[model samples]
Target: MARVMRDATVAATAEKIFAACGPSWLGDSYNHWSAAVKAWAVGATRSLPDDDRRAIVYKTQELDDALMAARRALEEEDDE
Candidate 1:
């Protein structure tokens, strides 16, 4: 079974993942999974100060973006 990641340190959004390939995806991609998995991590991130929170959130977002991009590349490789 697919496990949905949940925690205070991870955050992600399926919207971004799904949008990466447009609406007409042939099947599930890594990006979709990555976003779902990462969304919660980003959401759960916590910091004592607002500035710290901002930095952490941005870092998480960037990591998620990179993972999504990597997934897209992998998918393309499989398609070819």
Candidate 2:
């Protein structure tokens, strides 16, 4: 379904963000990259109408989940 595909895209984007942010020590205040990415993602979707914006709530959650997974994977890689 289209919704599923869209969620997948959102997740992939979050994963990339996690990987890209892993190398930088952006300070404690800036450590919440997942949240920052979600905020950015949501804002990026603001051009959509109210209903469409509402539709991506689940997509945002998917992005958050993917971000966490990516973070763990990166940490494990560093441990290797």
Candidate 3:
């Protein structure tokens, strides 16, 4: 199905983005890189159908939240 394929493609792209820009304790560089990736994702998905675009946005937000949580955990560990 086209929708299934679109979902798979979005998932694959999310994985690559996460691998390349996952959270780190590097502060500004990490923030900048994450922002850049987010922008790139938006641009890349601009031509997708509405549903596909929404799926990618949701996935991206999910990944971003996970990365933020991981970063917070690392900071907590460092603080202890």
Predictions ranked by lDDT, top down?
3, 2, 1
How displaced is residue 55 in candidate 1, in Å? 0.3
Q: Give residue 62's lDDT in candidate 3 (0 to 100).
A: 67
The true-versus-predicted C-alpha distance at residue 56 of model 3, in Å, is 0.5
lDDT of 1: 0.46
Evaluation by TM-score, superior candidate among 2 and 3: 3
Quantify all predictions' global Cα lDDT against the true fold. Answer: 0.46, 0.50, 0.60
| Candidate 3: tens digits of C-alpha lDDT, residues 1-80 | 13433667887776676676664334334444446455665667355454554565566556666778887899999999
lDDT of 1 by residue, 1-80 (tens): 22233333324333443344343332444444444445544655542343433433454455556666788999999999
> Each model's TM-score?
0.42, 0.33, 0.54
Clashing pairs in 3: none
Please give the RMSD of candidate 3 to the true structure: 5.9
True lDDT of residue 43, candidate 2 = 57
